[model samples]
Target: MNWIFLILGGLFEIGFTTCLGKAKEATGSTTYMWYGGFILCLFASMALLIKATQTLPLGTAYAVWTGIGAVGTVLIGILFFKEPADFWRVFFIFTLIASIVGLKAVSSH
Candidate 1:
C-alpha cells in the first residue's frame, strides 16, 4: 500500500539523518562508510516518496513524511546522540504524532 511506502520513506529519511550524525562523529574510512549509508538511504527515501505520492495527496503525504522524519530523528538524537529530551520537546513530538494520525484519518483518498 502507498501508506506503507510512505512510512518506509519516512523511516529512510530518519536513516539518512542518522547517518549524517554518525558521519560527523566518524573518522577516516568510517566517515566515508556513513556517507555511503546516507546516499543509499536518501535514494530509497526519495524513491518511496515518489511512489507513495502517486496515490496519496501530496500535502498530506509530505507532511506525514516530514513529521515522521522529525519525530524519529529527534528520538534518535535523544537516544544515541545525547540530545536533550526535555518536557516540551516530548510534548511537541506527541503533538506531531497526533497531527500525523489526524491527517491520515481525515484524508479521503
Candidate 2:
C-alpha cells in the first residue's frame, strides 16, 4: 500500500511538472487552468509522499520519489520538449533507474 502511494506520488510529481511547463506557455485564462492543474497535482503528490513516509524510511522514500520524478521529467522533456537524447544522458538515466530498483529490492515492507 505504501509502495503504491509512493508510485502515485511520483507520477503526480511528473504531472505537476508537465503542467507547470504548460502554464508557462499558456496565455490569459488558459494559463490559470494549467496553473490550477499544477497546484492540484503538487498537493496530491506531496500528500501521497507523506502517506508513504509513514511506513517507509524517510530517506529511502524521498530518494525514490525524487528519482522517479527526475526520470519521468527528463523523459517527458525529451519526448515532448525536444530536448537532446544524447548517449551519456540516456546511460545516466538508466543508472538512476537501476539504483531505484536496487533500493526497492533491499527495502522491507
Candidate 3:
C-alpha cells in the first residue's frame, strides 16, 4: 500500500541521514562509499515518496514521512553518534510521534 511505501521512504530518509553522519567520520575511499550510499538512499526515498503521493493526500503524506525521518534520525544520532539524549529532546520526540499518529488517525486514506 501507499502508506507502507511512505513509511519505507521515511526509513530511507533515515538511512541517508545516517550515511551522512558516517561519511563525516570516514576517510579515504570509505567516505566515498558512504556518499554513494547517501545517493542511493536519497533516490529510493524520493521515488517512494512520489509513488505514495499519487494516491495519498500530499500534506498528510509529507508530514508523516518527515515525522518518521526526524524521529528516526534523532534516535540514530543518539544511538550511533554519541549525541546527547536530554530530557527536552526526548520529550519533543514523543510529541512529534503523537502528532504523526494523530495525522494518521485523521487521514481519509
Q: After superposition on all CA atoms, what RMSD does each candidate show versus the true structure?
A: 0.4, 0.7, 0.4
Residues 1-109, model 1: lDDT tens digits: 9999999999999999999999999999999999999999999999999999999999999999999999999999999999999999999999999999999999988
Model 2 bad stretches (over 4 Å): none
lDDT of 3 by residue, 50-96 (tens): 99999999999999999999999999999999999999999999999
Model 3's lDDT to the true fold? 0.98
In model 1, the runs with Cα more than 4 Å from the true position are none
The residue-by-residue lDDT of candidate 2 on 4-99, one tens digit each, is 999999999999999998888899999999999999999999999999999999989999999999999999999988899999999999999999
* Candidate 1 Cα lDDT to native: 0.98
| Model 2 lowest lDDT segment of ten | 17-26
